[model samples]
Target: MAGIKENWVTGVGFGNFQKAYQIYEKEEMIFRAYVNHAHNEYLELAFEGGVIAAILMALYLFLLLIAFTKIRRDALQKTAFLSVVFLLVHSLADYPLRTAALAMTFAYMNAIIFHRGFAECRNQSPELVEVDHNGDKLFVPVGASP
Candidate 1:
């Protein structure tokens, strides 16, 4: 077990897969399909971050669900949902959240969703009145033109 750990720590066991990723004209595998292969190296992020990665991933997914369900803006809600889906799917074969730019994007998306959700819920409806030039308050029908 100690030897295995040492080997992993030093990257002794993992080898370059240039051969594994070779292309054949006769086989004709598409780039899209090849990139989506189930056995790519998905361990870099998990191994580097250890248990924190799993915990944060779970938390992000939970927050994503809340954002999708609770956000009041239709466009923002749709955008958040699509973002979550894309990130989740992309995580399967790559640790997108590990890169600085992608991680910032993920954080930005979460901020928009959670902030908007909380803001909308807290400020549901407020009293408003219109004032005329004479400084008199005027009541206007909700749908009437001013």
Candidate 2:
């Protein structure tokens, strides 16, 4: 247990070091945090995970797109959008999704957005069909249809 905890702590420290190294690499090559050119955790993981990461990211994008367009309540829509932005911004610097606690929080936010979006879609009335004066078919709001 001690060994596992130490390893995780060291890994988190190393991950932060890689983020700092990327910033310093643009100006200098011998900075203290620069742990060679290969220690960047995010890039390394992306390379190692390959297609799995790509597919997961695609799904994440699709969820954001749907939530933004379909969420019925304005407040929930804004909250979900902000959470997505937060996850994206945080991921650029740290592996939040790789950490259990943070990952659970992310999953909760995603579930909320998806649930609300589906609920809104389900609640919408499908009785929008109408017959016009000349027997032509028309689509109008539920109460406005003749």
Candidate 3:
């Protein structure tokens, strides 16, 4: 909390978390080992990147959820969604995203969730027709089809 209060705008700069943690460490909380992270991913992000970064992260998660809702139902999609949920829950206790392998896996899940090609329109019906515009295809009501 002290770290956030002191550097809630631009943060202590990425990768300087260890040094900043030491500086912000409380006398009563002294430990033999150095503290590296805030433990909680969201808090760490806020402490390291400020409020804007935290908001951006929240927006990204919200958008990811929206994309997930739009994607076709499948085992892979279900697995990806479950994995993301687990990661999010785990983030409350530890910074799993800090690990490169986990981060890449998260990115892969996001790609799988956000790829429009993997989405199956729930509104598909004979009344709608697919139209292509500038190489992007979308379904529209027959009367509105180009």
Candidate 4:
């Protein structure tokens, strides 16, 4: 065990791989974590951050169930499910970062989707509103829009 730790610490045990990535996994992680393409880490971090942010936003949306009148609240629920689906698709399916930037991107996009949804609810007029008729209040019905 100690020898293993020493080997890892010194970066000494790595060797050739049967294929391109088979042997280079650790090196790739290091490269992704440090050196060039440093943006990869940032991108990954941003992806995670975006996930956390989405969760918080979803929580806020769910809290206002009664406020939105039936239709609007249902709409809010659908949007929340959309966000969850986005998170599910991203976290599962095991896609690579370079390949799955699409997922990260979609997560980011969903954040905007929900944010704008929240915003749209806020901007609506009283008569035209369903999920947000309270005005400036959070969680108003989210299904009343035509």
Per-residue lDDT tens digits for candidate 3, residues 38-111, read: 78998888888997888899898889778677655566777888888889899999999999999999889877
The global Cα lDDT (0 to 1) of model 4 is 0.42
> How far does residue 69 in candidate 4 sit from its true spot (Å)?
15
**lDDT per residue as tens, model 2, 57-106:** 67878868876776655676568668867976777766667768878878
For model 4, residues 14-122, the per-residue Cα lDDT tens digits are 2211132233346435443333221332222223334443455457546433323332444554565566455544544333344466657555644544454565665
Local lDDT at 146 for model 2? 22
Give the TM-score ranking, best first.
3, 1, 2, 4
Off by more than 4 A, model 3: 120-146
| TM-scores of the candidates in the order shown | 0.51, 0.48, 0.76, 0.27
Comparison by TM-score, 3 against 4, better one? 3
* lDDT per residue as tens, model 1, 33-130: 44322232244333333455546657877877876776664667568668857876787776576568877887777666667545554556545557
* Index of the highest-lDDT prediction: 3
Query: What local lDDT does model 1 show for residue 111?
Result: 69
Give the candidate number with the greatest TM-score. Answer: 3
Q: Answer with 1 or 4, whichever has the higher TM-score.
A: 1
lDDT of each: 0.53, 0.57, 0.80, 0.42
Q: What is the C-alpha RMSD of each candidate to the true structure, in Å?
A: 8.6, 10.9, 8.8, 13.2
